[model samples]
Target: MATFAMSDQLLVIIDPAARQTDGESVRIAKDVLSAGAAAKVCLPDGPAEFARALGRRGSRRPVVIGDDHALLRAVTLLHRERELAGCGLSVVPVGEAGETSLTQSLGVPGGAVAAARAVLDGTERRLDLLVDDSDGVVLTGLAIPPARRVPAPEPVASAAGRWYRTLLARTLPARPPRLPAVPAPGPTRLRVQLDGETLVDLDEPLESLTVTPGAPGTSGGGTAEVEFRPLSVGAEATPLRACGRTVTVTGPDFRYRADGAVSGPVRRRTWRLAEAAWGLVLPS
Candidate 1:
């Protein structure tokens, strides 16, 4: 990997929704960054603004001061802005205990002080990103089992009010929706192709068709990626696929879960991997 210079002035973006009760993590993060260097810790108005902040991050490195979801958003932003050439990402996992190391594995830490210290002395590594032109930036794994669509949210006035409702609407939890259960016969169909070669073609019910960064094409320039795990479940007609960087899917309208967030609906999509597109802080 080529060596790139790291930045000292960091922009901290904290996810406000995640810090409802024990909100002092955000304050600790703010103080840490402001102590030794010029820092700006700001709450993103929303996810779109969060991406915009990262896009316009300039020479200042981005140190996300939130949960793993915030880390995902920052990575997604980095993936979309491949022109950065080299930019380091810092993450402070201020969420539940389970996902502490989960973020660390990706080279981020959970403690506010520890993650902030990494911003000061962490080694940078070349990491891969998932990109889908059809579905936009890809950061995390995708799960597509049959799920009941969420009902439309009620209108709100104030930003705080809207945030509250959106938070509640999303917190409904992930379970088999309370609907009239019924039985059906026949399996779902999916035709998967990688680099124009057919990988799977069938009328079988699929649990998931996971695609990862394939090895860069011998002649064509791109990520060297492949998918090994294909978890097939019971009978259903809903096609499911998980793409890492780049993927191309052909069929009817297909609903996809990208980076844990579910999209409305779309079909005939392609995904591609962006490599070394973003920088991440690792433990020394």
Candidate 2:
């Protein structure tokens, strides 16, 4: 650890995966931070190193230079370390603009330089997170029962998929949008219980299911909600929200995505939502 002079500043953690860009992100980010204010930046090797950096200095605001996924990682780490409330987090997104800029929706921005600048002046606000007391901490999103999109085969596919998706984005509208491709066929049904009360037990095969925290513009409070929509023909539907501290969902083996990343083929799972668990630094 490097000795530091006391200053109103935050610790910056650059994602290892972001390093695949050969430090361009970090360099630009550092320059941004230095330009905006006096702060120290610590570059870590990987996820473990990032978390360790946080463990050592979570009390300080954390500004991550990476994608929304990295932001998710930070949130999960805060939850795991049981230091969610005391820490404030910020993010600088890098990657597919559409995909990466989603972090901006959380108050992060795309440019490393601009993002770092925001970190210096960003406002701290409480945010909601989904915590799986058993499996792990969920930061972004999750897929629950009634839909099994097993990602096909990820070995050579994920990259190819990204390339193809990127290429498609380049030709299409400059506006961000998900590919209009139809949802994958096949569905998995799930039974959901919120705060110990059964809310849904349906046989409808779902194309996808996701839960998002209440946004800055929205005021739902510490309420956690479960939404189910049939994927065979994916479309938005009225979602089910629960005001509870715990959520339990179980069914036959199913695939789930937590915070954009996939999680399980497990049959039973539970999520505990702790409200105002962490501080998020958003654009002001």
Candidate 3:
């Protein structure tokens, strides 16, 4: 890995969503970054332009000014191009509080001003990565059988308001709305293996599964933590847990949520832990 210097040139990519969501934060980040060091700012209109801008960054350290999705896009592109290990990335999260959780969890500061300062005056920390067979990268963690969401109940209105709404509904022409198609049920039986050893078989029904990268600077030696809950008839069974460098899952077809994105109905998938695969700039 190359040494990161404070005086190095920076390529700042401002995602469109960041601009649309919070212009003030974007402007603040740009101001702070520009005042600190030499930076070339690129306002990309879409994903294609963002990729092109990042790809063209020659010697400049890449600093993403957007939300978690933007950071994921940058990292995924570099990983796919085989340039991730050599690149030292930084981020100034500019989005809703909930949307920027990934960056925050990775040690990037919350506010734009603080994160921008960290980019200029912080050290690069190498972090582990989880790479799947499909070439997808998971920064934080993933959960099998994506979580289900219950819709919120309709809000109650006052009597006069309800009466007015009833009158308006009778007067206005009603059009049949196109309803969303419901998703099919997911696979229940899955075979799980860790480091070439079978942990669970298809005959055993699993309640849930989760996999996460080892904590930074830990003695886990670049292994991922895997845990699964088994469905029991009478009493709740204790969840099985293990640490391994590789994990494999085989089933009819299952969907998983990783790092805030849902992917795969893949019959089989394997993920390998890449020890210290990438670097992120964080406050010292």
Q: How many clashes in each structure?
A: 18, 5, 0
In terms of TM-score, how similar is model 3 to the real structure?
0.86
TM-scores across all candidates? Answer: 0.67, 0.73, 0.86
Best by lDDT: 3
lDDT of 3 by residue, 1-284 (tens): 23455677999999999999999999999999999889999999999999999999999999999999999999999999999998989999998768999888888999989999999988888889899998999999888853454444444355678788888679888745644545544336889999999988899777788999887533236889998886653126667789999999998788888998988778999999998998988887
Q: Which structure among the candidates has the greatest TM-score?
A: 3
Residue ranges of candidate 1 with Cα displaced over 4 Å = 1-7, 18-21, 48-52, 78-84, 96-102, 143-178, 182-186, 203-207, 214-246
State the C-alpha lDDT per candidate. 0.60, 0.66, 0.86
Supply the global lDDT for candidate 1.
0.60
lDDT of 1 by residue, 1-284 (tens): 32223346878887765566348876776777777566767677789888878777777777787776778767655655655356667777787665454476465666778777766667666565566764366543444444444544443446677778678679866545354434442333556667676655655444455544422211113453444233353334444433333456665556777655677466566666666555566666
Off by over 4 Å in 2: 1-7, 96-102, 145-186, 202-208, 216-219, 229-245
